[model samples]
Target chain A: MEFLLQLYADQTRWSTLPPDQAHAEMGAYAAYTQALHDAGVFVAGERLAPPSSAASVRVSADGKASVVDGPYPETKEQLGGYYVIDVADHDAAVSWAARCPGASHGTVEVRPIMAVPTAA
Target chain B: MNSRPAAYAVAERAARESYGKLLAYLAARSGNIDAAQDALADAFTSALERWPLDGVPRTPDAWLLVSARHRLFDRHRRDVRAERLHGALAAAARDAQRDFERAGEIGDERLAFMFACTAAAIAPEMRAPLMLQLVLGLDAARIASAFLIAPAAMSQRLVRAKRKIAAAGTPLPRVSPDDLSARIDAVLAAVYAAFSAGWSDPAGVDPRVSGLAVEALWLGRLVADIVPDDPETLGLLALMLHADARRAARRDSTGAYVPLAEQNTRLWNAAQIDEAESLLRRAARARRPGRFQLEAAIQSAYAEYRFGREPAWNAIVALYDGLLRIAGSPVVALNRAVAVGRLRGAPAGLLALDDVAVRSDLRDYQPYWAARADLLAATGARAEAYRAFERAAGLSVDPAVRGYLLGCARRLGTAQPSAPSSASEGKSPG
Candidate 1:
């Protein structure tokens, strides 16, 4: 099964960290991603840019689209990154999620990817 | 000739006994518990419809399996995923037929289904209810009542859990040996949770919650049968059996709560007690003591009272010490203190209780206050004891237990300090 692990954390904290501490944190995440690759379960992963640089788009029912600066309805824990991995089962996905560096101080939500049926 | 009532009885028996085995087999093959359950329900309906007219089948389980397989085939034929499921169902049906001819018993894939129910991906709170439904074939409403959840919400939760299991492709019968012990622990914890939920309602007054304890016992026996060599599995069964053996004596003729120490020994089930003792001995021979074993050993110490002997408080306290080292919680510490009070004087027990009183989790726990009240009254602190009794009664969920605690307080109010005595409390030494 395939799962998406969404890492949620305070996006602003990264800018205020000491250079050495920030480097160490980055190194921890690099090592975690490397471990996932070594385990042969890594599909794709990326650290998302800060929410301040992102935009939210909504299509109104009147066939008009509206765009908003920054994430809509800003929250304390912003979406920081995500990883899509293919594994044997949900338990395996959960184990991987626990090992993610973001899980130590943030939340790693594991969601199984829906399987789409193919027509013959 | 099979009358309608007799047919119904046979069908009910089959549903109760073979539901898990049949569902496990179907779900393992189909990889979708929701679909498998529907297929099994259809099979039962067909049985009810046909059995009365054609008489019961010679092998009811095999008959059900064959019928459910046909239902699965027919249901899949209309689906977009029919081709893949068709292949799997054909293979499953062949295996079922071969196994029936060879062993005359359905394949026992229940362990796999049980582990799947308690998989790490599932929410911790939902594991027990999911196990009750998937492994034991309990309805959502019955399980909802036992867990004190709304029926509709429980049904939704169960449906989502089943969907996740199927979507995640949790491998059946593929649990590695390295992960076996950990997975077994999760499964054991879920079963114990169900048993405790049921055990709390000793009076069994509510029709919805009444049969949960019995269903949990059946689940325990199924687990013990599957993993016979796992000492902790045997230990859990022994623990539940020890408590069950005292079920009848937990209440008096007037339906008042009777504490373990004051319960009438003659009303206890000797047969179940003997079985528990034997299982505990078997667990001891393995020399791998876990939390369940230690807890069972403590219960065994209390069972000595059934034979007209004083409970071995020393042994119980020592077992609690071991338990504290492993699975220390405020509840376990509170229970240990009660045993300490039994071994030493009320003052020593009070000191032990003080150590656990610092924990915030036990602030509203009824048993802790009840234990404190018992020790306070023993030491002749009438006012403090009365307040504690009232607090415990306020926290109690069971009316019988609350009434007993209030009665204790009332007695303390009317009696003289010179006549101070510790009244019995309910279900000590957890």
Candidate 2:
């Protein structure tokens, strides 16, 4: 099964950390990604730009499209990053997600990737 | 008739012990828990019909497994024929034959099934209901009654929870020990719920609920046996055992509901008490005392009263303080007042009672009124005590408890001797 672990945290938390601490955290994440790669379970993952860089696109009832600055209505924690990992089951995915450095002070919402049926 | 009842007793015992084990074993192997449970239920029904005549199988577990496997094979063949007909018949027959021959290789998988039922990925509220259904083989209605929910709602919740579990995939034997610990709290809560359902008098509506308490105890033992060093597991087992030990003493000779204070101490089950005490000691030695362990320690203090020792009011009050710190339920707070009254007089107990926030929270609560009446009567406030007793009696569901409360109201000014007590929330205290 493949699970998408969407990590979320306060956008300012990383920026407020001391330079050396942020750098150390980056190093830890690099090690974590490397570990996932070593285990051959990592499919794809990436960090996102802060919520300030995010743009929300909405379509009106009449199909008029409008772009808005920042997240849609904002939230306490912004989407920070995500990891897509192929593992045996949900628990394995949860174990892997728990090991992520961001999960120490953030949230990782694990959603199973919907399986698309192949052509017979 | 005698033989029939005896046969039923044997079947009941076997069902209590082997139902989960066999279902878990078959489900683990077959990978279709629903089908496995259906087949196992059919097997039990067949046993009810055939056991008395066949003189009960020498190995009921093996007999049930063999029957369930046949049922599974029949289900598989029916499904296969519905889809592909003769194309799959030969292969399916071979597979079924192989599975039947390999039945002896199946080991107990209930512990793993328990973890799966209480998996952290499942919603917290649904975990206990799921455990009751899948692990203990309780029907949705019985579980609903235990939880005071509509059976349909419980059934829907159970189906959703099962769907979630099935989607998660039962990763048999792959759960790490540390990961198992993370989910232990939910698992323990489920077991405790099972025990409580069994312990409570459900107005004699369902006798089967009573047997489930014993099964819950077995589950606690199984969990404790699996994780012997986990203090909470041991503590939970001790707590259940301690409560169960007083089952005999909970009623008078004429079968009236006797309060712990009024019951003859000699009626309490000594062996169960000893076992609970040892379990409590083990939990204490682990130095990881939690809510259940603290509660067990309080029960242990009450159990001391049976042996001619003064009911350890001081130790019980202290334990209640510790329990309040950890559990902090209003029920525990109310219970603590009884011990406080015993130790520091009725005025102090009433003061302690006042400190409990949200008095309106317990307006409909019978124990609160009962405790209030006890305290008032102790302080020689006959009129107030009588009113409180009337209120408690009005709210009480148990006829015996109602009679006891009413008796207190009738004996207003005479000042009857305050009986020795046990500190519990609703039911007869441990």
Give me the displacement of residue B146 in model 2, in angstroms. Answer: 3.9
lDDT string, candidate 1, A1-120, tens digits:
999999999988889989976764674565456556655788999999999999999999999999999997799999999999999976556656755667656888888999898798
The DockQ of predicted model 2 stands at 0.01
Candidate 1, residues B1-430, lDDT tens digits: the string is: 6567877766665565676887788688767677667767877767767766676678877888888777767766777576465566556666777888999988888889888888878897799999988876778988876775556778999999888788778447577778777789888888877877633321112112234666777788888988887888988899888877877876799977777777788998899889988999998899989999888888888888787897888888999999999988776787788889888978999999999887645644567777888889889999999877766654454556656666787678898533222232333322
iRMSD, per candidate, in listed order? 21.5, 26.6
Q: List, residue by residue over B1-430, the lDDT tens digit for candidate 2.
A: 4988887767766664566776676555555566556677888778767776676777776677667667656766678643343223324323444554687433566778887787767876677677777766778888765654446677888888877766776544456777766667778977876776523321111112244567678789988887898888988898888877777776677755666666688887789889998988888887877888988888788777687777778888999899889788776787788789889988998898787635536654557777888888778788888777666654443445555565666667466635423312344234
Enumerate residue pairs that collide in model 2: none
lDDT of 2 at A50: 90
- Residue-level error in angstroms, candidate 2, position B282: 2.8
DockQ (model 1, Cα):
0.01
True contacts kept of each: 0.00, 0.00
The Cα RMSD in angstroms, rounded to one decimal, for candidate 2 relative to the true structure is: 20.2
